[model samples]
Target: MRLRAITGFFFVIVMLGSVLLGNVVFTLFYLALSVFCLHEFNGLVKQGTADPNLYTGLLNGIFVFLAFAAQSYFPSKFLLFLLPVLLGSIFIQELYKKSEHPFNNIAYCFLGLLFTITPFTFFHGMAFISGSFNFHIPLSFLLMLWANDTGAYVVGSQLGRVKLFPRHSPKKTWEGFIGGILITAGVAVILSRYYTEYDWKQWVSVGILISTFGTMGDLIESMFKRSINVKDSGGILPGHGGLLDRFDGLLLAAPIVYAYLYFITNA
Candidate 1:
């Protein structure tokens, strides 16, 4: 428990510091994080004989993230075109390997990109919403996510009785779920006052989305691990398990929240 708390404290500092610094640091931080997560995902899935092309997949994932980040600086959309080529390279590279399940390898590699890379790419977009570096959106998103996780753990430990999803995650409970939403909503309200980019209602909506879908994302990752019969995604973090275990909620929430913010801002 002490080790987990120590790791979490430093993790929050690094994440928040990157955002506060500027767009470049934020983009680079998540870019590196995306690569590590892709590597971890590929490694974990490989335990089942899917044998994803980690090199090609990492290259593709890095390219995808760079393309997304480039949208902020470059006027021409030329770089985005490279994404398809990068993705295609994965399939092309698979032919040389004598793996029995070539298609399965390709599929898991694609899944690694979709499940890990794409969401972090979307998160990079949040920093440039107003044609400038705005840390509030992404920072607020992280805060609400943390609130939900913390609230769920505290409330669930004390009052949880009924299981939320016994198959994927047995420790989760309906009571904790509700507590998380309520706590996130409260935090969203407070954030709205300072980060006036969005009104209170929109922030609350984001909180709801994070608490709901973020929990789902955690469960989904848990299901992935359960399918493979592994304990943690990796031992990268001292007590947080792995990058994937720590950021699983962000994986699904980032894209959804990005879509919501994009539509509202553009509309």
Candidate 2:
């Protein structure tokens, strides 16, 4: 328990620092995170008897992320051209290898890029919503996520009785899930006062989305681990499993929240 708390404390610091520091740190931090996440995803898929092309997949993922980050500087059509070429390379490279399930490998490689890399790219989009490097969006998103996790754990431990999803994650409870949403909503209320980009209602809505979808994200990763028959994703983070385990919620929630914010602001 002590070890987990210690690891979490430092993890929060690093995450906050990366976002608060500047655009360079934020971009580089998430870029490195996307790479590690792809690495872990490939490792897990390999355990399931599929040999994904790790190098090609990593290169593709990196390129996709860089494409998103550099879209402002480069032509928007550049990614439309670049991604197909990069994805084609995966198939071309697979021909050289002697794997029985060639298409399976290709599918997993694309899955890694879609599941991990794509969502993180949206995080960069969220930061640039104001046409600048404003840290409010990203920072508040993290805070709400943390609040949900903390609230779910605390409330679930004390009052949880019914299971949320016994198959993928038996430890989760409906009580905990509701508790998390409520707590996150409260945090959103506070965030609106300081970060005035959106109203209090909108912030609360973001919190609700993060709590609900973030739980789904966690469960989906648990499903992946269960299918692979692994306890943790990797040993990269002590007491926290791996980078995948740490950021599983962000994996799915980031893109959804970004879309919601984009539509709301534009509408």
Candidate 3:
């Protein structure tokens, strides 16, 4: 528990500090993390396999960085052009390599990078938006996820009698799941009053959805880990596991919440 808390604190401090610095700094940090995460992800895929020497991990890292930079700086048309170009390039490369499972590793690596980095584009977008509200959007994103996770832990520990999904995650319970939503919604209302222009009703709605779906994201990653018969994604952090283990919920929650913010708000 102490180790987890320490690691969590370090993550929060570094993340908030980078965001406060500016978009460019934040983008650089995110780009570096995206590469690291993609490497870890591909390593997982290639472990104990015949295709361990594949360069799909390196290529996927490059693709993620390029995609993020394009999405942030270039026009949508450029993005459209880049996609097919990248796909054809990867396909041709795989064909030339001709491993036993030539396409499988590359396809999965590319998809993993996409899944990991796209949502983070929203954080970069948030930092670019004009506002004098001290720019709490990034903090709010992390806070909401934290509230949901912590609330689920405390509440579930106290009153988790009914299993939520024993097959996916035996430790999860329906009561704890609802507890996470309520806590996240409560935090959202508070954030709405201070930083955001959103109404309490909308905040609550978004909060509940984010929390529920975030839990599902955690479960989905857990399912992947279970299928692969691994204990944790990696042991990079002290007690928090890997990037996947820590940010599993955000993989799903970030995109959903970003879409809600984009469509629901006039900003």
Candidate 4:
């Protein structure tokens, strides 16, 4: 417990610092984040599964992030360039390798990119959600996510009785889920005072979405780990398990939240 707490403290510090610093730090941090996540996914898949195109996938990750990070400067057409290149390189490479399961290789490479890189690209785009670089949206989202996690941990440990999903994650409970949603929405309401662009209701809705999908994200990752017969994604963060463990919530939530915010604001 002591090691976990200590690790968590510094983890929170780095997370806060990266966002509060500026767009550059935020961009650089998440870009590196996306790359590491892809690398980790490749490693996980390679344990007995097919080998993804590590270098090719990494290159795709880097370019994908750079294109999205500079959304204003880079033409959307540049993103189109990546699709054919990714498919062509993977397909062509597999043709020569004479692997036993080339289709699986091709599939997992695509999955790795979709699983990690794509979602993170959506996540970092939150900075520019308001037609400019504003930290409020991303920062607020992070706070809600953290609040849900903390609330769930406390409530589940104290009063959890019903299993949320015993197969994928036995520790989670209905009580924890409800507690997390309530706490996250409450935090969002409080956040409305500072980020006045969105009222309490909108933020609360966003909070609910994050908690709901974030839990799903956790379950999905748990499913992935269970299928692969692993306890944690990696030991990169000590007590935190891995980057995937830390941001699993962001995986499914980012894309949904991004679409939600965009539709509401633009509509």
TM-scores vs. true structure, each candidate = 0.98, 0.97, 0.88, 0.96
Q: Candidate 4: which stretches are off by over 4 Å?
A: 73-76
Worst 10 residues of 4 by lDDT: 72-81
Where model 3 places Cα greater than 4 Å from the true spot, the runs are 48-57, 65-76, 126-134
Q: Report, for every candidate in turn, its global Cα lDDT versus the true structure.
A: 0.92, 0.92, 0.73, 0.88
TM-score for candidate 2 = 0.97
Q: Candidates sorted by TM-score, descending order? A: 1, 2, 4, 3
> For residues 1-267, what per-residue lDDT tens digits would candidate 3 score against the true structure?
998889989988987787677656777887777666666766676664535333655664566556655555543556556766665666677666768886675667566666666656555555443332234766777788889999999999999999999998999999999999999999999988986566788778777867987898899889878877787889998898898888888778877777777677644
What lDDT tens digits, residue by residue, belong to model 1 across residues 1-267? 999889989999998998889878898999999999999999999898799887888888888888888888785679888778878988899889998889999999999999999999888888787788899988998999999999999999999999999999999999999999999999999999999998999999999999999999999999999999998999989978999999999999999999998999998
Greater lDDT among 3 and 4 belongs to: 4
Better by lDDT, candidate 4 or 2: 2
How many clashes (backbone atoms < 3 Å, residues ≥3 apart in a chain or on different chains) does model 1 have?
Answer: 0
Per-model RMSD to reference? 0.8, 1.1, 2.7, 1.3
Worst 10 residues of 2 by lDDT: 71-80
Clashes of each: 0, 0, 0, 0
Clashing pairs in 3: none
Please report the TM-score between candidate 1 and the true structure: 0.98
